[model samples]
Target chain A: MSDSTLTVERVSLRIGTFALQDISFSLAPGQVYGILGPSGAGKSVLLETIAGFYWPDHGRILIEGRDVTRAAPEARRVGFMFQDYALFPHLTVAQNVKFGLQFRRSRPRPTEHSQVQDLLARLGLEQIAERHPSNLSGGEKQRVALARALAMEPAFFLFDEPLSALDARTRDSLREELRTLLRELGVPAIYVTHDQTEALVLADRLAVIRDGVLLQEGTPSEVFGAPVDEFVARFVGVETIIAGRVLCTHDGVATVQVTPERRIEAVDHGAVRSPSVLVCIRPEDVALNRPPAKDSAGANQFPGRVVGGEPLGPMLKVKLDCGFPLTAFVTKRTYLDLKLAPGAEVVAHIEAAAVHLIGQP
Target chain B: MRTQTLGQSRGLVFVFSVVGGLLLAFILVPLLRMYATQTPATLMQIAAIEDVQSAIWLSLEAAFLTALLAGALGVPLAYLLARTTFPGKGVVEAVVDLPLAIPHTVVGIALLFVFGRTGIIGGPVNAVTGFQFWGTWGGIVIAMLFVSVTYTVNAARVGFESVDARLERVARTLGAGPWSVFGRVTLPLAWRGIVTGLMLTYARSISEFGAVIILTYYPMTAPVKIYDLFLQSGLDESSAMAVLFLTASLAVFIILRHLSYGRVTPGGRRM
Candidate 1:
């Protein structure tokens, strides 16, 4: 790792009934390591522990190759943006941005005042520099918080559900804005959130945590496309996960029997050592077609009836009973053109490459 | 059903207004009647008296000192109570509030046991410094503080509780030490509650009679002096002094409240 990299080495901490067990991850400069977890899954606790708010029981936190495990938060040079944006209600926007500048032990930079003004102006907050937090909108508070944290010129940043409190419309726009800002700043960051889309968009590297345990860590697509377990499959938006037994393997592809009469073809990747397995399929990967009259089923094709579906924006989330329940995402136009509705017979086609198989534990 | 519920609420409001208005009148009528009995000339005469002036000054000074001391000693305890959980915290909170539950005279006697000339703390300090709490300004301040410190501690605790702990954590992340965070973030955010508490402590201390008379009857506070005049002369003479003291207290209280309120609502926005 480079000198600017942050490494959490085998960190384990227990707060109340929740504990993070031997969790470890590292982030290089310009990397956004997103920790994705459900509520009460100890994501916030892990972030706080890294920020020096809580000490780990058995681990070392190294920032810039220096152990900061026992350091006070002020000595750690880590910027933390809270879920609620935690803007000081008593201070104006300009003053809030200027707050950390006075505490710097280094000689004051000549352009410090202009630097703060530039930050606020860049975030489009210069007009309301004199307004208190209560007078600003949710998006405005978020920008001010970002400016304040960035003003400190921290080595790393930790954001806990930074956009969770905003309305959906604001959250969507700010999510893109935040991604651009993080990329431009080139500071390593740990963004913790339960929102899958946010993690997918913002994370250069992603880790899924559950019940205080780190389940999986990889690139966003690697973790989303090839989940290690059934929980991860469901969490990363894989709508269909069903138990299956491998019947045969050939050319790195295995035919798994989901039911007595139904089977699936999945690329084994040589990880499946057991006969029992889970067939994980993303909804978008399943293609729907008209059922054939003859019972000439393709390798990974199954005839089924549409049980129900609902329109999700421009796409439709379709539930089909292809011997076993399977979910498919089809465009609204496809649904209309196919005259697909409840009780309509259709064929679901899943390619071997699209099917992810995890050995059943 | 909604109309019936609205009508019932209206009836409840009517009943509340009647009872509340009667209580307000009950409190205001006595003070108004006392004030009506005193003319401007008589009140001016009582205010001009050197003894009355000195006694009122003593009350203000003692109460101000009590408030300052309570703030310095009680704010940390308040912050701990607001932020941390510990064993026997309930006991500590109850002890802080014990004076409010006890009679003022009992508080006076309880304080006298610890602060008298021959008392545990008072004896050693008097032996070393040749200063005593008996009939001294220290006794007056101790008496007032004993009965009034609860307001400062409780109010400051509530104030500290109102501030979000995350703000302090963020301040630390921005390179502020513990004391800097407290001074820059927590103190500013919690000041309103602390100030309100101090104001209540000052008002309560100034009105303290039972405790003050027992501890130091010679260097008389306004309340004790008014009691002395009522007993020594008659209602007419004492009422003039009462009117003067009441006016002074009301003026100071109103001015303090106005100043705080004005600062709080700079843009005419209700926080």
Candidate 2:
């Protein structure tokens, strides 16, 4: 790893009944490593352990090639943005931002004031500098928290659901703002959240955790597009998963018989070394077309009927019975263009590469 | 519908006012009657008495001293009780509240066993430095503190508890050491509770008569002196002193309450 990289090597921690088992990842500088998990999955615990709030039972956390497993949080030089923002309710915005400057012994006195001013200005918090936390709105508090943490000039940043407390509109805007801010600061950050959209948006690399185990880690697209297991597929919003028997393989494609009457072709990717497999397909990748379209010879296309659908914001989630149950997400414009409704005849078209196959024993 | 609700609420308010008014009159009637008994001239005469002045001074000094000392001693225990969970925490909390459960005389007697001139801590201390808690200002302070320290500890604990632990954790992450976090974030956030606790401690200490008389009668606090006058002279003579002391205590109490709940900005700075 580079000198600016943070590495957690086989770190294992057990708090009460929850155990983070042999979790390991490395984050390069200026990259945001997002940890995605459901509640009680030890995502926050892992972040806290990296921040030196908890010591791992085994393994080590190293920041910039220095072992910080046993260092105090202050000595670790890591800035943490808590889930609730955790602004000092008793301090104004400027005071809260300046709180850490007093403890920075290495920095000379002259630049600290201007540095705080610069951070406040950068976060657009100068106008609210005199306001107490209680008087500010949720988005204002979040920006102040970001400015405060950035003011510390930390070596690394740890954010625990920093936007979770805000309303949906605020959270969406702040997530983009946080991503831009993290990039500008050039600090490696571990953003932990259970929200998949947040992980997809903010994470340069993502890790999915469940029951304290690091299930998978990769680029957001890589993890979401091709999950390695059934749990991961489901967690990443792969709506169609079916047990299949691989009857044959050719040209990196496997013809898997999902049911006796239904056969599908999916990219093998050399992952289908076993006869038994699970066919995973993302809902968004499945396209619905009106019947009587030209079906390319031997292409993965099946005639189906729309069983039901519900409007999901601008997209419609259509349940299809294509000899087997499948789900497809289409835009409202397409739904209107096709005049899709319950019992509407449709053709489900899926690409070979979109069909991710996970090997089963 | 709004008229019906308003009518029902008016009837409820009438019932509440009747019971609350009776309770308020029960407390105020005797104090008002006593004030009416003494003219301004007679009350000034009693306040001019040197003995009464010294005794009132002593009471204020001892109570203020007790509050400061208890704050120094009790705040850390309060923080610990609020933040940590140890094996015997329940027992420790109960012990902190033991004085409040017991009578003041019992507290005085219990303190005497530890701080009396010939007692455990007092025996060695008296021999070493010729300092004695018995029949001294120290005796009065210890007696008052024993009975009133609970208020300080409990109030500060509630204050510390109201502060989010995450704030302290974030402070630590922001380059603050543990002590710096406590001073900057925890203490300031918990200040209102601590001040209120100290106010209550001071008020309770000033009114501590049972423990003070049992420990030391020579350095008479206002309450003990008033009792002494009531026993030696009669109702008329002591009542004047009582009214004077009552007025002084009320004035101080009201001022302290205002100071404790003063106009503090949301940032916790006093405005």
Candidate 3:
């Protein structure tokens, strides 16, 4: 009953032994909800179900407040872009775009002809409109698919790994254009991808799905900043997860004891019912240096030796065994300034907010 | 191992060439000799004869109709076999290829039992419509279709299989119905293979002798007529008929192959 553009309520489906259990989410107008997961995680299957390709075994699907769970794909008024861009191989580029336009049930707009032409021109496909899909490059095929979907003027768009088939160079260049285009359309979209970077770049809100289960859903920063479980923490690039026991909670902060003499302060996520919890920290959030000034107070600092350093482009991943293992990504300049080879002593500084608490171990 | 010089094996080459040459000549010599037996003037004269002209005309018409019928009935079945998994799919496929496995003469006799007058379905059909299949053009078409329909079905199946299923699903999301998706996406992409099937069906139908002779002999097809003439008149008359039929079949085959690649039209935009 919410006023979201699309709502999937308590959907469950079983295909053989694999089952998608109790998936529920809603999308507001003009919002892009990126479903990020690895391959075979039912990301594409969920998209297809929302588009009305398959009826869920349980639950309701609504588009713009109308229930369409049992409706056919064409009747659902949902535009879908497939992973491979699925442009009709026999049709010319113009014909492919015009295909959806021909099926519009409403009155013809005064500028119908100009609308298709404008889309082709907007996608930089005016010159290739006469050519068949077999003659198109990967990026061109993707644009053609987008144009075809847009021509339908559906209630919302569902994209399934739209850029996964493109080469790395084409994907990088097309990502920005696609982002701008989706924003300009001002319609709700659900973009599905297995690549975390793609999801982070394109999603307003994100959901990390795993093995047909909805693991986590929130804004990109919320999910990336504070993952709810170890699977998610690792999936989102949080390399350092320390097992700890919650010693106490005061105000909104909780002290989790990592070792016999060491303790770290983290924002107390209300779901921490158990005495034992996992302290999650991202490598990029930790700062590595010799030591802080005496005036700098209330900084979580630890002295450790650099066990290994691997250069990752402009940064270095420094592995340290400080009583327990910890990893930090330092800038190349920091790595060079420290001259810190193996067994070199260095201090790692972490702010109170940088340490995130996961309620479930 | 040492490499042998090209000129060092001239004697061995001569022996090999002589054997290969004889096999090639074995096929070409008979056909060439048949063609050379008729002067251009005699070929023209023989083509104008009433019996010869009618028999050739019947053969072409029946084959063309058979191809059209096969395409209409077989393409959908081919698509089904290509896309879906049914319980008896293997059995269905094996039956489609059964024509190729069995002898052509046995196929003729098999058709007789099913489509003959007083046969199972044929008896009821004749009783209701009063149109007999035996010794009629209907019989000839059925006979030709039984043996040649597989070529069309298998070709169309290959064509439909090559089309990615994602294309159809994408079309559906674009507001196209199932029929629209097939016509706009599946059929056109698979056109070349379907055309090849049609060509094979037509050629097989026209050249069918045993089946047509058994099912319908009154409205004589070209092959049956040529055989009859060979028995009554001589080799001269039959060879002249063979040359004429071969030339016509070749012309049609070449035209089909040429048109297959250039079927691009403004409407379909086929590649």
On lDDT, the candidate that comes out on top is 1
- Report interface Cα RMSD per prediction: 2.8, 1.8, 3.5
Question: Sorted by DockQ, highest first, which candidate order results?
Answer: 2, 1, 3
Candidate 3 lDDT by residue in tens digits, A283-307: 9988777754333456467778899
- Pick by lDDT: 2 or 3, better one: 2
Considering summed lDDT, which 10 consecutive residues are worst modelled in model 2 chain A?
A291-300
- TM-score (C-alpha) between model 2 and the true structure: 0.96
Model 1, A1-361: lDDT tens per residue? 4465789999999888889899998988889999998998899999999899999999889999999999999988888989878988878889899988888868467768898899998889989998988888877887898889888888888999988978888899889888888887787899999999999999999999999899999999899999999888899999999999999999999999999998899988998899999999999999888868234545777889999999987689999999999999999889987778999999888889999999986
Docking class of 3: acceptable
Error of 1 at A194 (Å): 0.8
Candidate 3 C-alpha error for residue B232, in Å: 2.6
lDDT digits (tens) for residues B177-225 of candidate 3: 9998889889987887788899899999999999889888888999999
lDDT of 1 at B225: 92
Off by over 4 Å in 2: A1-4, A296-298, B1-17, B263-271
Off-target runs (Cα >4 Å) in candidate 3 are: A109-111, A121-124, A291-299, A311-314, A340-343, B1-42, B265-271
Candidate scoring better on lDDT of 1 and 3: 1
Chain A TM-scores in order:
0.95, 0.97, 0.93
